[model samples]
Target: MTNHWAHPTAIIDEGASIGEGTKVWHFSHISPKTIIGEQCSLGQNVYVASNVTIGNSVKIQNNVSVYEGVILEDFVFCGPSMVFTNVRTPRSAFPRNTSEDYRPTVVKRGASIGANATVVCGVTIGEWAFVAAGAVVNRDVPAYSLVAGVPAKGMGWVCECGSTLTFRDQKSVCHDCDREYERNQDIVRKTKDV
Candidate 1:
């Protein structure tokens, strides 16, 4: 028997791979060939389409739909009612139903998408990046960046522990987690205390 837990109302189709300790709550549907990693939580009304890949410890809140061509790495957080689009331009008359027509979206490890955010396809959300609520992400987000507003503009940098970083001469030390960070132009990276 699988070690995962799915509520009675949840539909886990055949060929879906759910890792140990994964919990799928009410009204959730996991399509065939989808792979979800260990300790993940899929909240109510979550719909994960076929062939989607979600990594360990991912938390997908209620009303979220993860379509095909979406890859969520470990520690990713998808807040309530967040949207993910696979097709760039959708026309009902001419359907782009095939996987080749879909654009792939990769959410890197530790990235957090806030509530009601919409992530457009083909963009890479960098590791430890944070997308604020209701933001529409259309472009690639740099690592450790905090992006907000429509179309998602980079507002500041954040530590791995999710605290906002204040740089002094391009260098910052997190007060919450005591981590060090350095900013070089548009890119930010964790640095060693030396």
Candidate 2:
């Protein structure tokens, strides 16, 4: 028997790769050749395409569809109803027939996308970034950045521990985790003892 758990109602197509301790809830469908790493959670009604790659310890909430050309790294969180689009300009009359036309999207490690957010393809969401609910991201997000609003804008920065950062003199420190950061123009990087 496979080590992972799948609901009796879930449909896991043959050749789909599910890692140990992963769980697929009711009414979900995992397509063949999709690789889901260990300890991930696939909620109800989720649809995973064969070309997608999901890393370890990921949590996907209910009603999420992980389409082709999307890669989610370890510890990423996909909130309920959030989506990743494969085509930037889609039309029913001009359907994209080949994978080459699909723009790939990468959600880096430890990022959290809120419910109802839409990540446009060809963009990279950096590590530990947070996308608030209802935001539409069209560009690359820097690490620890907090992006919101339609056509998402970087409004603030967040700590890896999930706290809003307060900057002083272009430097911010996470009170919760005691992590320090230095801001340069629009980018922020963690300070290391060098």
Q: For each candidate, C-alpha RMSD in Å?
A: 1.3, 1.8
Q: Number of backbone collisions per candidate, in order?
A: 0, 0
**Alpha-carbon runs more than 4 Å astray in model 2:** 192-194
Model 2 TM-score? 0.95
Mind giving the per-residue lDDT tens digits that candidate 2 earns over 15-130? 99999999999999999989999999999999999889999999999999999999999999999999889998999999995889889999999999999999999999999999
| TM-score of candidate 1 relative to the true fold | 0.98
Worst ten in a row by lDDT for model 1? 185-194
Those runs of model 1 whose alpha carbons end farther than 4 Å from true positions after fitting are: none
* Whole-model lDDT values for every prediction: 0.97, 0.94
lDDT, candidate 1, residue 128?
97
lDDT of 1 by residue, 1-194 (tens): 99999999999999999999999999999999999999999999999999899999999999999999999999999999999999999999999999999899999999999999999999999999999999999999999999999989999998899999999999999998788888999899888543
lDDT of 1: 0.97
